[model samples]
Target: MKQAKRKKLKKTHAPTLWIGLFMMGLLVVLAVLAPVICPYDPLEQNLAEFLKAPGAKHLFGTDQLGRDLFTRTLYAARTDLWIMVMAEIAPFIIGISLGMAAGYFGGAIDWLVGMASDTFIAFPFYLLVIVIAFASGAGSHGIFITYLLVGWLIYCKVARGQSAALKNSEWIAAAKILGYSNIRILFCELLPNIIPQAIVLLMTDMVGLLVIIVTLGYLGIGISPPTPDWGTMISEGQTFMTSAWWLSVLPGMFVVYTGVALSFIGDGLADRFR
Candidate 1:
């Protein structure tokens, strides 16, 4: 019975995992190779070709500024994905470490961590992000600062729960009895166990983060001009939605595609880890 159950689980998750990996990997490769393969400079403009529809010359058509939409889209992928990964690094590390410490030490440490996370959770997530971003000023700096302030809360919560549960386990008590230092037990024992769940959360969290970035760009507080962000592109194209719908639609589609890919990854990982 157990063997059959294990096999069923494997069959269900394995395909989803592989499909997501393939889709995401293809996008990454294309973005990385954008400079080499792109026919035109993403930022270059030609008044003559402005608003030209998709054709042999311009595969995805030209925007209002006469820049190649295809090129800009690729470049946008590069910018957004890079920012997404970089923005998460600090929060991931700090959140996991703090969560582990709080759970392992308990008492004062746990209380403080709980208070901080709860405080952040009290407000609407996007509201906090927008306010912070507006105050911090535009571009990547604002985005990073906004994330740093709030992004760690989810990770901290997840890690804290896992650590707390594990702390009372027999193995944890055995480690204590065996003279393992608190630091060593927290990092060496607890971290390895908790990291898998955190990674699963990371996949889904990235999708949300990407959406936030696009929203910021749409609102004129992200990436800035000439940077080829999807949100900014959508905002710019909205004026011509009737005449040249591709401008807004194409970028929006890519955002959905990327989000779907990440969602698959998160779901698959969750199933696998379970």
Candidate 2:
């Protein structure tokens, strides 16, 4: 039974990973090739062709400013990918480190970490992020700073819990008895075990972070103008919905596709690790 289940899992894993890779790879390629492949400057505007429908000359149509929608969409993917990568780094490091300390130490450190995590998780997650983003001001810098401040709590909590559960295991005890340094035990011994779960969390968080960024852009508190963000594009297109549906719909589809791709990757990772 166990052998059959493992074989089944192996069979399923490849396709899932491939699907995820295909979608994610497409986004990366679009971003990388934007300079070479985009038909027009994402910010270049020609009032002459304003709000044209999707067709041969302006594939994916033109926005109100007559900027090529397809080009803007492609550039938006680049912007989003960059922002997501930058935003995730600080949190991953701080959260995992602090979580390891809190869990492994299990004294005042654990208590304090618990208190901090509880406070952050207490509020509606999106609400907290919005308040922070709005207060920080409207730009990618603010968004990056806001996420760094609040993002680590989730990782900390996860690592803490996992560490606590493992701190009492035989191997850990053996390592301790062997006089392994705290740093060694935390990084070399325990971190390897905790990282898989954190990685899964990282993928899931990527989706959420992407949504928050787009939401901020929509609300005028995210990436600044002329940068080609999907959220900003969606917000810009709303006024033209009655006549220029493609303006909003095309950008929105990009967001959906990217989100779904990241989600599928996260799901695949979760299943593979399980």
List lDDT for all candidates, in order: 0.92, 0.89
- TM-scores of the candidates are 0.96, 0.95
Best by lDDT: 1
Residue lDDT tens for model 2, 126-215:
776778777877788877877887899889989999999999999999999999999999999999999988998998899999999899
Error of 1 at 255 (Å): 0.6
Which residue pairs overlap in candidate 2's backbone? none
Candidate 1 at 1: error in angstroms? 6.0
Q: Report how far off residue 17 is in candidate 1 (Å).
A: 0.6
